[model samples]
Target: MPETYRVAIMGATGAVGTELLDLLAERNFPVEELVLLASPRSVGRELTFKGQSIKVQDINQIDFSDIDLVLASAGGSVSKEWAPKAAAAGAIVVDNSSAFRMDPTVPLIVPEVNPEAVLEHKGIIANPNCTTILMGVALWPLHQYQPIERVVVSTYQSASGAGARAMEEVKQQAQAILRDEKPVTEAFPYPLAFNLFPHNSPLDDRGYCQEEMKMVNETRKIFGVSDLRLSATCVRVPVLRAHSEAINIEFQQPLAVAKALELLHAAPGIKVVEDWDANYFPMPMEASGQDDVLVGRVRTDLSHKCGLELWLSGDQIRKGAALNAVQIAELLVKKQLLKSKTVA
Candidate 1:
């Protein structure tokens, strides 16, 4: 584009939205203007960006025509109504929502896994779900060496996946429980303080919840493997940030643990964080605030000769959502793929 692009962050007050602000400043994205869009309730509230106080604007009242890049972390319903409008108004939208992820027209992207997919975006680019992004970054390196035959994953997701309020709710719930008071439940159906549960998303006829199915479908799209066999079990844990996953991959041929660890160590957007002597691998606490997906526990699976097992922890809000979106924007900038005036 231009010397610098005018960018906007939709749902700018939410957890992911705020992270977007921080990442853009930290990464030094080519920003001429940074607009923050939120709900009417959050209007007039100010958020810091490069030490500048930018007021949150009502999404309904903002004009998108001159905005070149829109980083959308608003909920699905909000993005559903606004993202297209932003794209149609000539801004390329990187949407962090489930609304258009499975849409054949929209390319589901994880910059590390499918940076080429950024070029295929018609107008709006879909950011893969947090759990999907975490697993994809960790698995794609190995999959590149040999095509993965199947994938089995279970997620220990944190409250940050829900949003800012949900994260605070967990803290409040823990406090209320210490006082022997009933924890308030609003952000989630149950108190996520002292307990965990199967993902609260709606379940389908096959019994997989929405969060689980998202991993299954989005990973296939990102990997360009429509028939990729994958299964997921997502759980909400008491952790406030970062997400962890235990993944099992069946490859076409036997892959050694040393080879797997070597691949991960050299892979982009990933860090091999194994400390066997201390019995520590990637933990959510350590993964928090880090840009890289921390991966460790590489070993061969006993059930199958060609199977490999691994574990990963990543900042769900940073690398999982906002960072992935920011990387897509950077890819666009590098490839000269973004347009000043997107024609819908």
Candidate 2:
């Protein structure tokens, strides 16, 4: 029998955190003990796990000595402060925030593409952004066939990527607009009902949103191709869950659509759902709540050599956050790197 792990989930009350709990149960991850941690505001709230109620605890007060792994999705600031403390106490921290992703010593991992990177972690392993994670999963298989030189991608990300509050904000605003009342815009900069926002995060000096920059940087790191060129446009769509992307890639060698389909079909963690003639393609509704990244609409790019264009979709909360983090933990366990001494 495999050794059961004692796990702690930081931000257990949020959307991604809640999804993490569901996934842990769904996958039947060997959990000898589970600790649910949240902010002070959420303490004492009841959350059901494995058919039993588990009370949420304030993350600030918990001791981490017994935790085998810490899956943190609380936010970058919270992760920045607490992840190291958990690590120092001999727990392998798999963080979902951007806090430690770009750190030279911390391995940013996507289990399908870079599981080996987990072995190089210094107690903390970073999960790639939701958009980046799905994109890398689809692109890695193609890259292995013919080296990709550059990519241009546009994302239609859902509100759930922000949090449960953002999801509620969209729903509430839509109803308010129907009732002729002014819609609230606290969670987002603009009304997210029947509209789209081009900026997914604060703009950098170069005019790219932080979310876009993450896709560009994190892709390079995960693929181990630092000089690869990538340009992205990330937009916030009004959809409640799942993110969709249109990507065009320029590769070193020519790849046919039939061959590309073959490669993608065989890729791990990817599902091909293409049937253009039948009016079938990857969609947000279908991708929501799914664990696999769906790919379709494969064709030749008109403007570039060895070029290919495709559409991809996945649950931003699952493939993007929770499931990916848990998958990393599974990889650590499979690699025998989840042991406390290995992390320390």
Off by over 4 Å in 2: 340-344
Question: What CA RMSD would you report for each candidate?
Answer: 1.9, 1.7
Rate residue 172 of model 1 by lDDT. Answer: 99
* Whole-model lDDT, model 1: 0.93
What's the CA error at residue 213 for candidate 2, in Å? Answer: 0.5
Model 1: per-residue lDDT, tens digit, 1-344?
34578899998999999899999999999898899999888999999999999999988777899799999988899999999999888889999999999999998899888888887888899999999999999999899998999999989999999999999999999999999999999999999999999999999999999999999999999999999999999999999999999999999999999999889989999999998999999999999999999999999999999999999999999999999999999998888876554333
Alpha-carbon lDDT of model 2: 0.93
Q: Candidates' lDDT values, in order? A: 0.93, 0.93
Query: Candidate 1 — worst ten consecutive residues by lDDT sum?
Result: 335-344
* Residue 332 C-alpha lDDT in model 1: 86
What number of clashing residue pairs does each candidate have, in the order they appear? 0, 0
Candidate 1: residue 240 Cα off by (Å): 0.4
